[model samples]
Target: MFSRAERKGLRLAGGLTLGFVLCFAGVAAAVLLGHAESGDGGPLLDPYLVRVARFTLWQAALSTLLSVALAIPVARALARQRRFFGRVWLLRLAVVPLGLPALVAALGIVEIWGRQGIVNDLLHLAGLDNPVSVYGLAGILIAHVFFNLPLAARLMLAALDRIAPEHWLTAANLGMRGPALFRLVEWPAIRRVAPGIAGLVFMLCATSFTIVLTLGGGPAATTIEVAIYQALRFDFDPPRAVLLAALQILMTAALLGLIALIGRPDEEGATAGRPIRRFDGRHRRLSDGAILFLFAAFTGAPLIATLTAGLSADLGRLALDPLLHRALATSLAIAFASASLCLLLALPVVMTPRLADRGGTDATTRFLARALPATGSLILLVPPIIIATGWFLILRHFGDTTRHAPAIVAIINALMALPFVVRVLEPAFRTHLARTGRLALSLGVTGANRLLRIDLPALRKPLAMAFAFAMALSLGDLGAIAIFGADGFVTLPWLLFSRMASYRTADAAGIALLLGFLCLLLTLPSASAEPETKGRGNA
Candidate 1:
């Protein structure tokens, strides 16, 4: 339905986005391959690199196991106890970690598990002298579980929720309880989503930078991302950084390929809009309650600790700190720019398919349409640091890359948020077009006229929500910033990490609180809109 200029503009936008990604990939490959160090007739796997890779895989595997293993029972308990007081809020609480900045969550984990933390105080009160050391693999796993368990639980619960109410009713009629009920009814649903969830959790843990960076303590606990960061910034080893980046990309690609091969969850029967009162687990009320209580405490304590610790800091001093002010301003500017860029690029990438449909038999449009979304999401596989490092290598030849930090950081952050933007907008665009395309076409409305009056109105909410989500993701991101951040170009996360690095615990706490609040503020608009979206769906 678009005019020539509108269609051209869409093509131009998609072309530029695709071009940028191709350029990044091309330059990165050239630089990294140019520097690939194969040691004298041997493979490039140095002992140190091997150790780091092994540790990375080991930690990720353990984190995935613990998070998914714990999530199963917690999800089951929450699924069964659907009518308890505050159950709705508790369900909501399970997802709170998804919004939490990694740095903020790490701080909270430290507060609850550090030697000087609440746990140690309780231990001391009990006449125990041994203190918990949350500074190694134990700390990394704890932080990952703290972040991923709720996510796993929420995903598993969604699968459980999809179980047709009739199945539950059938189980109740059959007098099925616990193991028998789970084996026959619930396991299928959980099993359907489990592999996908595990893969997702594994990918997250594997690529995790902020959590591992903070809790890794020293060399023994470093992951590939951390090692890459160290290689570039600390050791100034570009070759090693390139090698690590290549390894990370290959590992992620392999995992993604594996997950794809595993296939999607089989579709289940649809549920009516009726409440599901599960009766099979009635005898486990006390047990379920205990499980939920323990899980909640496990997940919720760090959040409470973060808030309390932040509150205990000198707010007035934090307000007056020049560094904090600069970081906040820098963060907001970068976040807004990143979010805007993400939406701008995402719009065309998502629209390409629809526009291509008009081309009918044209293979080029079809190819462009299919390839753009995957290309946009390709940023996820290649971590921002790798992109930043590649750009760093290219730009350092011209002049100071530090001068280009803001733009570089914003662009990478935008790209990092691209998948999410596409995820949010593609469906809305598709739905809107499916419902309105013919009417608009018949009314002789097309191009800018159709866009401003028709598409914009229908898409405003999703666009705004996408912007907010992208802004939140960029606001909390430390990956790009970690690579490009300089003294003059620090964002909130960068500044927070800097403080924590210099043993400024009090300053770090205050910054974490501020950063968390800003992220939460950006996220709330979308979070609050969920019910409204669901209401529309139900209607």
Candidate 2:
């Protein structure tokens, strides 16, 4: 029997389509406002914009090179190592940065690597000055590598896990060791996924704003996003801001284009990769053991420090402040709301193009539609400060900033996190639909029932995971909140910043730890929900 929801597919579809329309409307309105403010001509390019663009790309390239080059040993070690002391703990620890806020991570880095930090303290004890400059390209690189290497290692480890046991066995039988085995097995697999991992990580570093701002400390160290913020906040240069926005679009698009060339396909016919024998050589054993410790320390120490700082923070005093409490409340609300909003906005974009035709999705069109999220991801290209500045100007011109208020911040955060929502959900969505598509059709399954009965159960895991990731992304965001969050619309990170500036280090660290835990809590259900792929068995 057809469920009530199945009968109502048309209505649900319409509502979903409407939501997408509204979401896209906000994007359109923002651009139009920006364009009108710039005058009759298009966004004009200037010398400053050129300089910012060059620095942004240069730093991103350098960071990418360092991150990937460094990740090689870490990834290989994780892949080769199967059992060791706290190895699993190390692997999990490395993923912390992915969910941690950029600002929070920056705080930890400053505490650890700053002039009065451990490194400098040791240097001072040695009879040398604090020669380490933690505020330029070097500082930026340190933070990027810190965050990106663990991630690259994970991706590489996953890639490395796919080697066939037969290949290893045959190599052992043929007395193939060292270089020959690597070329036959390791090389092929790493070659396949390396570009994708590098592209993703590189693009991530390329567009990063918060790390650049906190660690940059100077004009030349600034990225396009940071520069856009400067053009708006410091110089009030609208034209330059717009120019940087356009530049971000161009560069990020080029990066994503490269990603397309290397990423694995996700079509219906795609199967789980064939499995390979897990490595068991003595050399491999030692490599895995060292990898465990290296990645663990690289990823874990900062977190341990942050958590320690947080737990020891004077939260008893901090919470006594009304503003801190208010900011905490606001951050929590926006994080959840933004995540939900992104999911709603993506449904139509994902489902509509397929439902309208019903002849199974056209691969090219589907991929193109998938690109919508990435394209909209350009919001991240322009810093929240820049985006807020533009909107602030546009709103002020209309004689009202109060009217937009928290809604503006919420929308921007939602859109900024939209790409991740779409990307994470696309595969599971397709899988669920493909598995049940024809079955649901003949049964006349339609609306919420169809979604719940056929779609939800099948997609329950991925859907839940997508939501968690979106929430985590939103929670870590610093963009829109930096500007729009003023006047009582503050977020946790904003509050932490205010406290740290006032020398309330204990409070800031406490809030940072709290924020970290909250993100972890949000991430759990989504992750545990997804089933393992074929080649993912313990190596």
Candidate 3:
């Protein structure tokens, strides 16, 4: 459907994506092979590795099951109560955790459930001798649920919203009530979408880094990602790090493949043009009210604690601290650079011509054109720690890796943000092209002229939104920073984590609140304007 120029654009875009992927793979291979040649090669399946892997799987499974199971009642309650006050705000709050930095959220959790936190303080005031500990397995599970439960509830709530009004009417006419109504109408809706949500949550929990590190408490709670970090950073054992990285990649790939087989939850095509009148859930106000109140409290308590603790912190002193200023400046610089890089990388794939336009193209060309975006998104399957480990090993051979740590971290952060940038930009880019591509072509406009004069102006808003999201994501990331942070290379999350690890709770709480506020501020522009219907069942 395009002139010769468009095809050339497509080819260049495809080549760039392929080259990026190959460069990453090449670095990883070099690291693994280099270590194998020099180190005393032992079997990959050491006892510790085996134990960590088993614990990783076990925790992820339990986390997924709990998040989904708990989401059911919350979602069902929201679905039935249609016109309650503050409902929209409540829904918006459910998405706040998605944008929060894991470490910030972990700090928030600690402020609520730690030994000196509100819960334990209340218990002590009541003359109870027992106090709570927000560390170890309990801490990990609580943090995971705090982050993932709202996501699961939102997805399940969206599924419930999709059920037809006709079905509800039929059930009512048949005198269906309570268990019977759920059996006939609700269960099927949840079942259809539950598998995909479970898999997504499982993958997330399995690859968890910041939460695991913050709450792990000891070696018994170590995850594969943490093990890889220890092998490289603490032991200086590249061979072992490489082995663990390879295992993580293999396990994640398997989970992703299984998710594909189960199919994605139906997230698109939600209609808000008309309202549905519901016949059920009219007489169960007491139960539904209790459910809603409990979940709201569960999700809201930590955030409230964070805010209260942060309010009591000495912000004036923190402002004058050189370390905080340096870390803040570094984080801003990295966020800006990474956001720009991600947009540049995502544009080509987003602008690739659709396959339907390949009227005269050969099969191979069409296939490559279609595969380019998939390749870009496939970067998600390779955990950021794995990429960082590979590059860290490679840089060690040439010189001190510390010198290049910040730059390396920025690149990995950009790559991790690529999938989100693509998701945000692709739809808007495609829609703009569908409207203007033929017109621009007919006017003999192509390449820079078309992009500058037509596409850019029309897509300015979405492009900005994508940039903001990418920037926020990079700013909050701990994965790459965890591997690279050192004396002269501290970022905000790194500094905050150090404070928390050293038992400087007051300073940590201040930094956590600051980081959380920054992320929320960056996310507001997009969140306010975007429709709630999009990405309904997606985490």
Q: Taking the tens digit of each residue's C-alpha lDDT, what string does model 1 give over 368-439?
A: 788897898888788888888887777778887878778888888898988888888888999898999889
TM-score of each predicted structure versus truth: 0.94, 0.85, 0.94
> Candidate 3 residues 1-539, lDDT tens each?
35687777776776776677668756766777677677677876989989999999999998999999999998988888877887777777787888888999998898889888888999999999888778888889999998899888888887777776667767878988889888878988899889988998999999999999999988999999999888877998888887888788889999989998998655433344455566766787789889888888878888887877777789889989999999999999999998998888787666664643636777656766677667676656788888888888777777777788878887788888888888788788778878987898899988788778988899999899888888899999999888888887899999999999898888888898899899988886566432243334142
Which residues of candidate 2, in runs, are more than 4 Å off?
1-46, 126-128, 262-280, 284-288, 356-389, 400-403, 524-539
Which is better, 1 or 2, measured by lDDT? 1
Judged by whole-model lDDT over C-alpha atoms, candidate 3 comes out at: 0.82
TM-score result, candidate 2: 0.85
**lDDT at position 509, candidate 3:** 82
Task: Sort by lDDT, best first.
Answer: 1, 3, 2
Clashing pairs in 1: none
Clashes in each model (backbone N, CA, C under 3 Å)? 0, 12, 0
Highest lDDT scorer = 1
For model 3, the run of ten residues with the poorest summed lDDT:
530-539
